[model samples]
Target: MLTFQPAKPNQLDAIMTIENQGFTPDEAATKPSMAERIDRISDTFIVASQDQQVLGYVVGPASDERYLSDNLYDHLTANNPADRYQTVLSLAVAKDARDQHIGSQLLAELAKVARAQNRTTITLTCLKKLVPFYERNGYVNEGVSDSAHAGETWYNMVKTL
Candidate 1:
């Protein structure tokens, strides 16, 4: 059975592997950034694991802003229980695990956490190609994003809780 839970320190390697596989070098979070997130926002950083192996993860910090800023990828803070919005900095499934619904499950798990924390919405930025995938998972495309991350165009996707 697959389980969804807060990430643990030991899972960093597995998470990094999946992250590196899912995103390009410019788009993937650095080791330091991922480490900080695991340390600071474990409550909001969820991992999907099966048989002691991590399959994927959804991680971010709670924020007052509705949309993500480029700084968020580099600077992460602890999740504030009182924050109104939940931002997903990264949601990645291992390449070998793509055909399954691990990504969607990770998103659902995050939404559950966000709603329990009294958040109003969950927001993220994605490359144009993945907009429809996020849309199928309940996010609305809010047009082009201001993000210049990886020098690629991104779309702001939001899901109201």
Candidate 2:
């Protein structure tokens, strides 16, 4: 049995584990970065858990526009905290815990919150290889992105709310 809930402070260690496992060092959301995201945790930040173990998590805040190549530090720091468009900053699951719809479930929960908040759209960037996965979930690829994470090619995707 899995439960989805807003992220809490203690879950950072576990969440970081998954983030590290699912992404490379360059692409990984590092501890400080993850801490920053936790600090910025809005109603959008969420975790997937069963019993006391966290299996996955996702988070995003509202923003109107973004630059494709900017890293989180640059992009987020330049933003007005009051930005109104949502960007799915991180969506990661434990390696052994994937293939169980956790990602889809997280996205569904995020969508519900977006609608309740009257958000304009939900947007994210993924490697070009994962474009089809997002497309399967109704996200439209707007264009290729120039990512700050070297060697990674991203595709900007969005789903209208």
Candidate 3:
């Protein structure tokens, strides 16, 4: 059976292992980056495992500068309590674990955390190729972006909770 748990300190290494394997070098979060995000958003971070073997994880900052309601970063760090909404910084599954709904489960768990925190939305930026996938899973495509990985086009998506 698959079980979900809050990511632990030691598990950051394993999470990085899967991330490095799934994304391009620059796209993957380095250990220190993951550690920093963990420090900021541990309550919103989670890992999925079966038989104690890591399969996937979803994590992000507890709050970010970008706001979907206006699609702009706050110029001076204004607090939009909604800004505390967790941004899904990373979502990755093991190579052998694709097509198994692990990503969806991770998303559901993340949503739960958001709701518990009184966050009103869940947001993410995805590559063009991933737009449809996120749409099929209930996220809305908001706009295009110049921040694509490896020069690919990116789409901003969000789901209101």
Each prediction's whole-model lDDT (CA): 0.93, 0.78, 0.74
lDDT of 2 by residue, 1-161 (tens): 99988888788899999988988887776687777676665467889999989999988766766533355534444334455566787888899998998988898888987777777678888987888878888889999876656467888998887
CA lDDT, candidate 1, residue 129: 91
TM-score of 2: 0.88
* Sort by lDDT, top down from the best: 1, 2, 3
Worst 10 residues of 1 by lDDT: 74-83
Off by over 4 Å in 3: 64-84, 146-151
Distance from true position, residue 81, model 1, in Å?
A: 2.2
Point out the higher-scoring one by TM-score: 2 or 3.
Answer: 2
Clash counts for the predictions, in order: 0, 2, 0
Per-prediction CA RMSD (Å): 0.7, 2.4, 4.1
- Displacement of residue 135 (Cα, Å) in model 2 is 0.9
Regions more than 4 Å wrong, model 2: 66-82
TM-score of each: 0.98, 0.88, 0.84
User: Model 3, range 1-161, lDDT digits (tens) per residue?
Assistant: 98998888878887888999888886676787777656656777789999988899997654554433222221112223555566776899998888999999999999998888787778888777888878888999889854645555667788888
